[model samples]
Target: MELDNIDFQILWLLTENSRIQWKDLGEQIHMTGQAVGNRIKKLEDNGVIKAYSLIVDEMKVGLSYTAFILIYMKTSNHNSFIQFINEQNEVVEAHRISGEGCYHLKVKIHSQEKLNLFLNEILEYGNYSVSLSINEIKQRNPLIATI
Candidate 1:
């Protein structure tokens, strides 16, 4: 959908804090609360606003290990592999990619034992390269500029 500057501003505001009241958002963009609400509803109806999510601290939840698993699956086993990954709650994100791997998965587990078990299970499908994340340098809301 074609988004005007107000729509973009609304999206930007929502990206930063989804729970922001319509009155507050309207003040930021110089629109009425009702107008802001209507726009947000329209955005949702059009599927522009897919989901509202919380960015949880994995460490606080005892899931300190963050691993990226690059998967290589047999061409014929694509569907089965996809199903397998979908059923795994430990997998936070999965992406079908190009270049060296068939899929890349971002997973989080509470312990190394769980990580090892998860890895061993996937090895039955094909080769994989796993890396543990040491630190996160930067994370930004895609809707806004760094400055």
Candidate 2:
């Protein structure tokens, strides 16, 4: 879909704060609340807006550790490994990538013990490397850059 300046403006506002009221958004963009709602609905229908989410502190939720695991798998076992990873709740994101490892996983766990247990479980499949994030420098959706 061809997204014009208004659509980009709507998205920019939403990206900054998804919970912003339609009336406030309208005021920011010189439109009525109903018009803002209509534009958002159109964006949703076109799949431009995929999902609404809240950014929560993992530490507050008892998940304090965030680990990146790189896995090197045996050939012909990709699907089985993917299925195994999919069943693991601690795995927030996984990607098959090019380079040294076949897959990379982003996981959050309550403690080091849980992280160890998860690492031990995956070791049965193949070799892997784990790195814990000390701090997050920056994170943002690329859609905002398009604006």
Candidate 3:
């Protein structure tokens, strides 16, 4: 979709806070609330705005571990493995990757025991190297950079 300057502004502002009121957003850009709402509706209809999400503090929620797994599949057929990851709650994000591994997974779990159990399950489909996050330095909405 061809996005105008106002559309980019709307996306950039919404990226910072999805719950921002249309009236407030319009005030910043010199547009009426109805106009902004119409634009947002079009953006959503076009799949430009897929979904709104909340950024949760995992530590506070008892999700104590975050790990990235680089997967090397042992089996040639990967359909079952793809389905496995999709069904796993701890697997927050999984990407079919290039350069080194077949897939990269971002996972979160409550404890070391849970993490170990998850990895053991992964061994059924693939060998994986995991890196546990020590600390998060920065997290930002990607739309901010694009704008």
Off by over 4 Å in 2: none
lDDT (tens digit, per residue) of candidate 2 on 28-133: 9999999999999999999989999889988888989999999998675588889999999999999999989999999999999999999998987888999999
Runs of candidate 1 with Cα error greater than 4 angstroms are 145-147
Best by TM-score: 3
Using alpha carbons, what is the TM-score of model 3? 0.97
Residue 118's lDDT within candidate 3 is 94
lDDT for each residue of candidate 3 in 12-122, tens digit (9 for 90 to 100) = 999888999999999999999999999999999999999999889899999999999999999889999999999999999999998998999999999999999999999
- Alpha carbon lDDT at 3, candidate 3: 96
How big is the positional error of residue 79 in model 3, measured in Å on the Cα after superposition? Answer: 0.8
